[model samples]
Target: MKIENAVIITNKTRLESLIERFNTKAQAKFYIEHSGGNFSDYEQEHFVFKTSLSAVVEKLSVHFKCKVIDRSYLPNYIFTEKDLPVVLGQDGLVANTAKYVNGLPIFAINPDDSRYDGILLPHNINNFEDQITRIVHDRFVYDDITMAKATLNDGQTLLAFNDFFIGPASHISARYNIKIGNENENQSSSGIIVSTGAGSTGWLSSVCNQVSRMSETETEIDMDWDEDQLFFVVREPFESKHSKANIVSGYIDDAHPLIVESFMPQKGVIFSDGIEKDYLNFNSGAIVKIGLADSKAHIIV
Candidate 1:
């Protein structure tokens, strides 16, 4: 692809969030100190992130037209095919950006290596320029990470780089008719989590850990980041006179998708990548098909 513009995706730092909440930096600092929290940690984090971001912008602007957008505007922002996305923040930021970038190659940077684990960010401030040079020459390498897709019968769809949550919007049990292949049943549970290969180590792994501990046995929970299939687990399936827990978990592929018909009167939703604000209503009369998506997240390695 001929990349001519660089779109930088960013998220609000802790300090910025605090300031927004308290209406001023001084008030934010006072509130944190009153709550026995260390305000300096927030300040330090903000400084490091700004420094790194400035350097990234300077480098990208040398060759390509640059534009920056916050994480909140991702759903409404229109991205063109000739744009390269430069993600500079935590690993979750990268996951959040991938869903809306339309499979564009991402140059992920770790602003603070000491504070963030940065599993998705392979580029640091010092070495990112070399990768930029490669990008300028159209010689950069990338890895294709698999993604999960949730499609509603009404034609609305949501894509996830990590996983998808299908259930109620509240603390009550979710009611739905779940079908995988020929096996199908009505289930009442906390919710259902469908995990992509890149997301197996996240919420999916925690569920696996709990099950393994309860069963007192070892279980394999994670898969390759680029695996074609997806794993799903129904959380806390409750057996009742109206619901059955026979189909609690399974793998979803191209041929056999996990289909769910909602029986909830209200408050049911389906959201991806833990962003509950951006979701599809899944109340009664809604049927959703969960499967592997055709688009892959192309991250520069």
Candidate 2:
């Protein structure tokens, strides 16, 4: 559907955060300076982002009716049928915005090319006018980025752009019964990270790097963004009398996916893309079904 209204998604910069904490820009600068922090650095970054945002918004307003929303408002904002989402921030912002967009084709716009590598963000302020033109004419092409999903036993499901973390909310051992194919185990680990091709490099790469450095096991973690299957990693599974660590990491294909039953009496959580605030409860009786979501993110590459 071609949307006439564009929704520009963005997040607060460091300066906004500082002002939120101290109630004013002057107080924020005062606090930072008194604490020996580089206030000028914050000012420069904020200026760049704000200036870039103004330009992007101005360009977008000339083409379509634009509605700018903070990244935090995505969860509650009801997206209309004619809403066009233009994400303007870091890769994390795109990933964070992707799950809530309901499969709207995203125009990933990077406000500042120098600070962000634009992995998820392919377009910048210098060239987004063309992308918008293409989008307006329904001539834009998009890639179907695979997404990970976690369905709770109570029928609640959560979507992830990059990955999903199933474990304790705090720094504690997460006890769960993991099932895959004909194998199952009662394991005690930090948690499990389930990722799609879109999120292979985000947290999964870090886990792979740590494994590559610390161990001799050939725990290869590689994924294409549009792969049908999902990859899962059980973080630091410990071997004990009842807990096992054999089925540590593998692919979660159609036939074989990860099923984790929470054994933690409390504090068990299921969150995605590193957003700990937005999560579903997974207590002792919860069963989280991990697999690919029915809908993929249509990202304009």
Candidate 3:
């Protein structure tokens, strides 16, 4: 497909966020310095990010129409097949932008390599324009990353490029009934995390770390990024007279999905990719099915 436009996705810099909170840059600097923090670090990070973003805009503008959008607008942004997504941020930004891109080829550029561990970013400002040129010539290579999806009985759906957290909104035991294949049980625990292969090293890895530390044994759960299967773990499942912990961790495939029914009267939620604000209410009477999404994130590697 001929690319007609490039949508550059970005996020507010830390300095910008501090300014927004304190109402001015000088006040933000005063607040940070007063708290024994280095205000110049923020300034330097912001400067590097802006410089990288400017370079990205300049490069893409030469070959295609370019428009920049903040990360906050991703949920409602309308993307087309002919529109190439050029993300300029950390690895998490690529995960955040993947859900809304509808499988468009994403060319992720690491804006500041010194500040970010860009696991998903394969290009840097030094060599990104060459890849863009290849993309314009229809010779760019990409990887189709699998993603997880949670669908409610009410028809509401949420996609996760990394993982999904299902539990109470607040810090409390999540009450729910979980079913996979034939087994079913009522459980009270911290929450449940369903992770795609692309996210096995993310939040899911921390959970694995905890298990390995507690059991004194190494646990390996990583998988291929394009694998169709997904993994889920029940965090801190508690066994009681009314709740059982037998149904804990398991794998979900296309033939079998994980079904959860909320028993919490209020504040139960299902959020993806660590964005708590973007979530679906999982209160009483809500049933959600977690499985592999039909779409994938086509990332330029």
Question: lDDT per prediction?
Answer: 0.93, 0.89, 0.95
Off by over 4 Å in 1: none
Over 38-156, each residue of candidate 3 has an lDDT whose tens digit, in order, gives: 99999999999999999999989999999999999998999988899999999999999999999898999999888898899999878898898789899989999999999999999
Model 1 lDDT on a 0 to 1 scale = 0.93
lDDT at residue 275 of model 2 (Cα atoms): 91
Off by over 4 Å in 2: 216-218
Distance (Å) between predicted and true CA of 256, model 3? 1.1
Off by over 4 Å in 3: none
Against the true structure, what is each candidate's TM-score? 0.98, 0.97, 0.99
Relative to the true structure, candidate 2 has a C-alpha RMSD (angstroms) of 1.3
Judge candidate 2 at residue 3 and give its lDDT: 76
Q: List the residue pairs that clash in candidate 1.
A: none
Residue by residue across 68-162, what tens digits does model 2's lDDT show?
89998999998776988889899999898888888888889888898889999989878888887788788899988999888998999999999
lDDT of 2 at 47: 89
